[model samples]
Target: MPIHERSLIRPENLVTHENLVIDGVDVSGHWSTFITSRTVTDYNEAMEEEISALPGGEHINRCWQCGSCTNACTVNAINPEFNPRYWIYLIRLGMEEELLRDKEILWQCVSCNKCTYACPRDVVPEAVMKATAHWMELKGHTPKSPSTHFDESFTGSVIATGKIEEGQVMRSFFKKTGQPLNQPWLIALVRGLVLKFPITLLMRLGLSALIRPRTSGWGRTQAALNDYVSEVEARNSKALGLDGKGKH
Candidate 1:
């Protein structure tokens, strides 16, 4: 099959370098505002600072649409709609709305660093996926897929307990994602795997109670979440037409 007809934008049009469009919106008034709201960008600088800070950042500036990065990304290889190359292009160009809305396309990543491992210049598209997930979360947006919950629930349990209690985390995650505990067969399968390893079985049965993890202090985590809440509130206020988008 031919490639041109399948693409909405030709590969040639992509900017492999770090240039911005001067006409539509200046970086300050439009780009930085949208970027900062998502925590991926600071008011003074874009992801370029982080990208350039990477030892590979110098060549990242030279990525001239050869599709090397895109060809390297597993997400793009499987899903024709995904284009890591263009995503980086969007970040560089400061297409604010487009960048924010990009969050709607989620769970396309499997956290595989094959693209990063394969990059000749070390662009680290896997890091970009991580950045995108954090940015999306800041905007009060969530992925439709359960993969995220699969991680967050476990991690949240860890954050709360300093170690994961498999049984507790499973119940918590299932409740959050609206998934029920597995049927009897599934539970049996899991127990069978555990019981086969006596040491692991003893550990799972709470024989290691003396070494159980203690929780972290709540003061600092509360402060962090409070800051995030404030940022979301600020952005959502403007989103409700406070940014003069609704004055008419």
Candidate 2:
């Protein structure tokens, strides 16, 4: 279906004449307005396939342009340019360059699931948005988001020691996202904890922080997890036509 919304049309593409006459008829302003036509030649035909290979993008082929997802998108309500339906349309047609025009706003999906709930084809627009964001990051079209940094920090801590240290995860996440460790809110939180926790418990927590305790017999499990992560990364890279180091 064609997008008939005037706002969706780029101003440069819409041409208008202040005063005009065509075929002995006086037509100006809205009557003389026209959209410029152009041919697209830079399509990435494997885009849909590459996205499908990522988690949460498996059902991209089911989209039928019903517009339900966009109608229910929470982000779209706040930001008109954040259109999931339009992005999916571009992806299905492999219009990679056009899609990249909105690359910065693509990661703004809040995973509200309203779009998913409204989708008739079970497209799961929420997941598709996330997959698209991940694809953009892997393709180097955008940087890793703060949420991605936090997830990696939390996951890395658990995978390394089979347990998570809240303070360590927070520190790592802050470092990766270039945030200061001494925020006022964090300082207040630490002060409250210090005043509330018992002496022995606080000592144990301090000791744990220093020692970086690990789960017993985690060596074999860690090895298996590392192997799995490597395999998934290799598969994703292959799907995106990237080398082992994620370079094309």
Best-fitting candidate, scored by TM-score: 2
**Which regions of candidate 2 deviate over 4 angstroms?**
1-5, 16-34, 181-208, 211-215, 244-248
1-248: candidate 1 lDDT, tens digit per residue: 13343245434443232344458844443223221113334331344444343322334454455567677777777776677777667656655455555565644677677767766665566666555554455334564447667777776666555677776667767787886567798789878977788687667557545454545686577567667755654554343323434321
Taking all chains together, the TM-score of candidate 2 against the true structure is 0.78
Query: TM-scores of all models?
Result: 0.51, 0.78
1-248 in candidate 2: lDDT tens per residue? Answer: 23476786788998777888889877677755788888999899999999998989999999999999999988899998999999999999999999999988898898889998999899998999989999999999989988778889998998899988887898799899999868899889878877888696688778878888789899899989989988888888888888656443
Per candidate, the number of residue pairs that clash is 1, 0
How far out, in Å, is residue 196 in model 2? 8.0
Supply the global lDDT for candidate 2.
0.88
**Candidate 2 residue-wise lDDT at 137:** 94
Give the CA lDDT, 0 to 100, for residue 223 in model 1.
Answer: 65
Q: RMSD in angstroms, candidate 2?
A: 4.1
lDDT of 2 at 112: 89
